[model samples]
Target: MTARGLIFAAPASGTGKTLVTAGLARHLRRRGWRVATAKAGPDFIDPTFHALAAGKPCRNLDVWGMRRATLAGLIGELEAHADFVLCEGVMGLFDGTGPGAEAGSTAELALMTGWPVVLVVDARGQGASVAALLKGFAGHRPSVPLAAVIFNRVSGNRHAALLADATARHLPSLVCLGSLPADPGLALPSRHLGLVPASENRDAEAVIEHCAARIGTSVDVERLLRVALGSTLSAAGKAAPLAPLGERIAVARDEAFCFAYPTLLEGWRSQGAEVTFFSPLANEPPGADADAVYLPGGYPELWPDRLASAQVFMTGIRRAASEGAAIYGECGGYMVLGEALIVGEGQICPMAGLLPLVTSFAERRLCLGYRRATLRVDTNLGAAG
Candidate 1:
């Protein structure tokens, strides 16, 4: 089942979306149904929290960051595992990045997937005007279903009743899922972007448990799940992977280097690579029996101390490369292969003693995009040209 139905939203940031979606996922999971959680944009942090809440990895449906055909195939794969999916929209429901790229916008995804909207509005200041807001958002695009409205930060029963009455008049058929109180405590921690990465927060597990339990108790889980169960999910294309580079490739998958695209790994496997995984932060080295090694990108900045101290992992990678194993590194992985990395807090630490160059966070100035780069050396990834 492809994610049959999902949530389209507004550009309202800090609206407790994390709690609401986490709670929704948690609620669905408790009912013995598998839930696949998705974030609408290029957000890696939110998905980790969703996975923690639902005990399954959350998939991203960013049109800008993925190939349309690849997106369809992965969605199909997840549909088989998830009874229904809870997709949380990024900043407002319409804002997206890049020039001439409305593809990544939540509105576009809603239209493409034919999923309905569950607009989460901060209804504190709006009394009768809430009706007008709902009307505008509801009528923006016709085929995009306006499934329900959930008022967040309502002050009291009277406030909730007032908003509900106005909303009913504007859109009589629309359901108000429920009102969430302005609980200052419901707010989760955030960093430079949005929510802090799940790995950095020590109390993250406890927080997810609380969110799941609360969402399960308060939200109308059964009905929402029923609606999700009714949606259709299918793949957009067939997949036939190319031949693998070698017999075995041990990939680095700890907190520091965990950024492989799902399809790429699946592609490698399909081609005949006996892929294996080991953690770098845990000090596990490349598997002794492996023919090659891979290091992807992640928060190598956060764990400079850990990565610097990861002697065995560093040694294993270098040893494999020295032995002419087809080793490779992506962005963060590329940084890790260098001599040193300067952490965000202005601490310089040594990394894997491979390349003689030092990488500094000071050099980070938004190098992210769907890049097309030419290879300069032969590696497990591809050929040198």
Candidate 2:
């Protein structure tokens, strides 16, 4: 969409780009703009927040973990179906490693996407020296267009004007869209992983609404849009999300099984597989009497009673498994396929009974990390040794 483009960034982490991007997306949506939001790294939580703001599924545009071709395809594919693309860059403009031994970074994604940068500078605890920071950021990178600046956490009008004037010389013709003060009232809650999981927050809707209102009122949208629309068009290529599954598979998809990746589903489609989706918690049997069933991760523990009452779904699952339909699950899905899932209320709930396993979530310790796993035997995910 030639309409506009935006990449919200900062000198480093904690400068409020996530909030700014969320707010801007909300504001634009309020202005009747069809906003397409994306994150420039392998973050699950940020994209969740972006989705909340943009009112659409926000996808990740990681250059680091994905094949070059896959990355291009993801950017290009998501660029469709929106009036504008608002990409939120990862930590500071240049904070990332490459895939395996590859050298591509977030900086590379910006160049590849043909989108300009909107620097979000935290003006807190700084004065005229903000100029030096801008100079270093501008000079440290080449080929990345520094479109404009947004001074975040400014103390007051006089403080903002001074910071703007101080940095104006280094960023010739650069417009300070507006300054955001350090608002104690607008901060999002954090978790060990970062901002609290998007699924667990009640204030998320209000947070986005408030931030959007602030950004819409403060930032110069016209200037930002001009810079975004000025970017040269590039071909992002076609990359599918799902991996290749066999001929046909029945995928459990609903509130209980919603953590499946878009890429994985898309990849299955590419492999000429018929991936039918259905709900297990809603008492709906999977679509099609397929050769296999995939149950991905989600909050299955929260609705144990409903899932237990879903006899139709459980029976269908058992029948599918009995017919030699390969059954597989990950995390929560893995827990659900077990014989019983113990709830936090000390209640045991019946599951698909595919396996004689039981799971409990009363003592949850976050299992967070990147994985480097290889298969040892043939499973539904792929060919094993």
Score each candidate by Cα lDDT.
Answer: 0.73, 0.76
| C-alpha lDDT of residue 109 in model 1 | 75
Report residue 369 deviation for candidate 1 (angstroms). 5.4
Per model, state how many residue pairs clash: 5, 9
Question: Which stretches of model 2 miss by more than 4 angstroms?
Answer: 1-3, 98-104, 229-236, 241-258, 266-385
Residue pairs that clash (backbone atoms under 3 angstroms), model 1? 2-233, 9-93, 10-92, 10-93, 11-92
- Model 1, 130-225: lDDT tens per residue? 888888777766666667877888888888889889988878877776677776556678865567767767777776666666555555655554
Candidate 1 segments exceeding 4 Å error: 1-3, 124-126, 131-136, 139-143, 199-206, 216-235, 239-246, 258-271, 309-311, 344-347, 353-358, 367-385
User: Candidate 1: deviation at residue 146, Å?
Assistant: 3.8
lDDT for predicted candidate 1 compared with the true structure: 0.73
